[model samples]
Target: MLKSWRRRCRRKTGGMPELTIPSHFLCPISLHLMKDPVTLSTGTTYDRHSIETWIEAGNRTCPVTSQVLRDLEPIPNHAIRKNIQEWCVENGSRGIERIPTPRIPITSTEVSEMLVRVSEASDESRCREFVAKIKQSAKESDRNKRCFVANGSTKVLSAAFAAFSNADETVTVLAEILSAMITLTPVLDEETSSNLSSEHPLQKLVWFLRFGSLSARRNAVLALRSILSFDQFKFEIVVKIEGMVEALIRLINEPICPTTTKASLLSIYYLLKPTENSKGIAITLTEMGLVEKLLEMAVDSDRSVCEKALGVLDRMCSHGEVRERARGNALMIPLLVKKVLRVSGMATEFSVSILLKIVRGDEGEEERAAAAVEALQAGAFQKLLLVLQIGSDEVSKEKVTELLKVMNGYRNRIECVDSLDFKHLRRPF
Candidate 1:
């Protein structure tokens, strides 16, 4: 029976042996023929994409041997990749497609030369064309992005390319530069960010965001998120660029794509993290009606979109003024209650957090008690009880408990709060 099965398999493979990949050509992690192979310090080879994903997830163990990853550096297995390419070519007639040679990532010398050429470009179109090339190359893979950043691309681009704008149609070059700038964010150093921003040359990044093309706006906002990721102080400088805040605020209200909206929200999220004169960043966001914008987004069909919007709202509602603004918006309370369990666990956590903060409002504030009453009258107490009864994460259940306690105290102020409801709501504990 085994001999007959082997004969049949050989016949199916046209007598060219089984269609088996050489063992060394397979990535240890994926157990598939390697494309873009690289070797880790554990002396194990993997496809670049697989290992990069593993490392990006914060995994420090080798997937094959369960050995601790002492270093993340992956040396490209160029020789093995070459052999795989040749093998694929030799077997091309039998259905194996030959993989093209992967483009070599930019080196420090190459990027420096490119930056010099970019600086000397005679026209905005020429500058943007080069920058677009850079952006396209960087986007090819994480390997390429890391290579570009490690090769001094961040410093070169920040100093030279950020200022390349056409007098008549400056948005394109500026946008492309910003787009490329963000790609190097993963490896950006604190000194690099400060050096980039202190030049104040990229404030044009902010200015163009208002009048630039949609592509330009998206790139600009993303770049802002990247630059500000390194230093919170830079956010203050960014918001100081006139119309920048309002423009970012306007991005939320615009009928933009999810990617752009999320970028805008993250920019605002970081900007709101730092305070001045004891003033919270949410004041600016709320004054510009950001709560309503986020509330609208909270009902988005996309789970991640809703999660991010709710996250921003959670932070915003931490401030009293923003909380009052959200209440005034009317959509905030209902949307918050509705998404409690409907979206991701993250969304539920943030939604419940926002409500909990509202319930535990400012000390000696009479309006807070009134707001809690209105929330109960809005059926929040019932929603909390239902959430506890249905069961949720420890975090969510704990939050529900705190919320029930706060609402129970407001029972005298709220006619809708029932004594029997307290027993059910608190039963989760």
Candidate 2:
């Protein structure tokens, strides 16, 4: 009956192209053209009503696209109503067809080349416009949509990363790629994450963190920082972070990545802050004995990594079990001392502030204070005195004074090093 109707429609339309949908597009319960097109609240059309009904039953899908629709509102259209009725009569009771999955085509090299050229072009405004056009094309063109999912466009993304070696340029490229990836990841298949081309954007992001120019590293970190909010991409993010952490640790040991770059990578770790779901990942890293690896970063020659490592440590220290694990591994004290001494002036200030908080007893007063005193005695007080003496400005002197007050107040069995001859300590001012 549905075939006869389709034939009639064709005949009436003067032999238009046959409406030959793959079995996958056919409704399972009704062996016919999809009816009511499961209009999601957002106006997408899908063939399956139960799926649409299930979505409508909850907050799930668009009526037309079956894209996980959210925030739906009613759309009134007479044509839609007519289409629904015509569809129900012809195929509503028919069984669904058993069709194989559709194969989306890969992006052609032409598209990839165009993307590369746009990414590398000197005109910022033009590049942005090109990116906008590509995104719009992806939304409107079936071919582009399929290509985005199936091919992942590694060559294009690599070209973008390669083009933007400078910080500003890198940031612009990163922003564009991030926006595109965020928009597409949800609609993509889980298998798409593994696609080498699709994974290129993230791979390049990691490379920037590892080996790119300083500005590129900073931009990459900033871009990656935004990806954490994409829930659909969480698994891929976790994988990327693990790989990044390992690479950063290795790089720190090699003395290749500049201090700023190392610092940027360390900052990126904060973006991966462990959530309830990410607790297992944290535990896995801890169990793998990465505490020592992380501690080593705190003393890195790069001031940026040193500061970032302290920030990372402060976060990890907030977790009692992780803190205990770090302390038990003898990885905490030396790092704390380095924070007080080896880091830049601003970093030293920040480190002292963090130490003050750590000693404020979130981990039970007795143990944490004891650790604090041990850290203080292990050269923080002496280093503070040196900073006070050699300090060239008021801010440094003020920071030293503040640190002294904290140390004096905590005078538990730790010996007080003599105050920097206040005379000399004051000379810098």
Candidate 3:
């Protein structure tokens, strides 16, 4: 159907004579043939879509006239519309066809009123209807979304979400709308951010992670990420939620999809970064068995997931409790060894950093030797050699050398750290 329309509009002559669109028929806003021409209060005529868009963006002046518009209503210029229609039919021999009547745009006032009605909705089914309509409007066009934002849809959505007294059935619908708010507006206002934070929206978001559908859960995660980016205080508040950390850990352990997996990992990773852990956030992560899950994720086939997983692993492993946690998990040593050259260079760096912390003996010499013996048994030497020949930067090289030197002292316990390999390993130092 689309191809036929394009073919009909082309000129048929061999020289391909230019299709001259009438100057008066063009919309000043888009410079295309006007379909539903409308006259503004300033007496300038524009295509309905173009002028409606201009007005919805908070502009009250005409695009062509620049006169301050007196009223919001745009009067339809039916005479110009009929004339354009006649010109299109007259040019139908050149494949041009009459334009179909355009659908009237949903008014900004209508959007604002709908949002107010949604916020004031009393029950689950009613909220669902409003959510569907708002999501449809947002999905219609970026223009509609900007208009919605201009009328303060984000605050209304957050307020409706925060004021929901019954969370059991409304969680899914509320989260769906909140996620739409995220997708529509690139950034949330500080007042909205403050509202969500004070109202503890993170608790509900964490709930959606476990109870909502895939789309609901995905959007919930995205919404959480946006709030967490607000500032350090919001991050601190979210981490303080009773089960928020565990929920992120659970998502990482049982991923619904790679995109959500990355989002969950990012939220957890940010929480573990250099905050005052007197509250034991990292310790809680370790206690909840995050280290083992991270080790598994570090070897993921997706390079980006693997890099982020390794990044979190590196941060967690640097903590005393988390370091001890990784050392105890038998799979951690070999996976770290295997991931060295298996993923991206960033993953390799993080993997090596974990081993260095273990092998360097902050936990004392016994822990260091135990780590060395474990790595040797896991074929750490085999993989380390591959990394050294390929991706290892100077810092990684030095760390590998230090690990091997530590392992060299424990060579008698391990079979793989043999005499011949030592010759190649020592040459680089």
**Best TM-score among the predictions, by candidate number:** 1
Tens digit of lDDT per residue, candidate 2, span 26-96? 55445555543344466544454344345446655543455664654323333544544554445543422
**If both were scored by lDDT, which would come out higher, candidate 1 or candidate 2?**
1
TM-score of each: 0.67, 0.40, 0.63
lDDT of 3 at 184: 69
Cα deviation of 63, candidate 3, in Å: 12
- Model number with the top lDDT: 3
Kindly report which residue stretches of model 1 are placed more than 4 angstroms away from their true locations once superposed: 1-93, 99-133, 139-141, 161-172, 184-189, 230-236, 274-289, 301-303, 314-324, 338-353, 356-367, 377-406, 413-429
The residue-by-residue lDDT of candidate 1 on 1-429, one tens digit each, is 224445666788656465677889887778788878988899888988789889989999998989998887777889999999999888765667777777665555666666677667767778778777777877876666777777766676665544543244565665667668776673356655655564254567677678877777876777666667775454556656778878888787884777778778877777766466214557877777778778877776589778888888887777878777776766777777778777877887898899888867774467667667777777778778888888887878999899888878887765785666567464644
TM-score of 1: 0.67
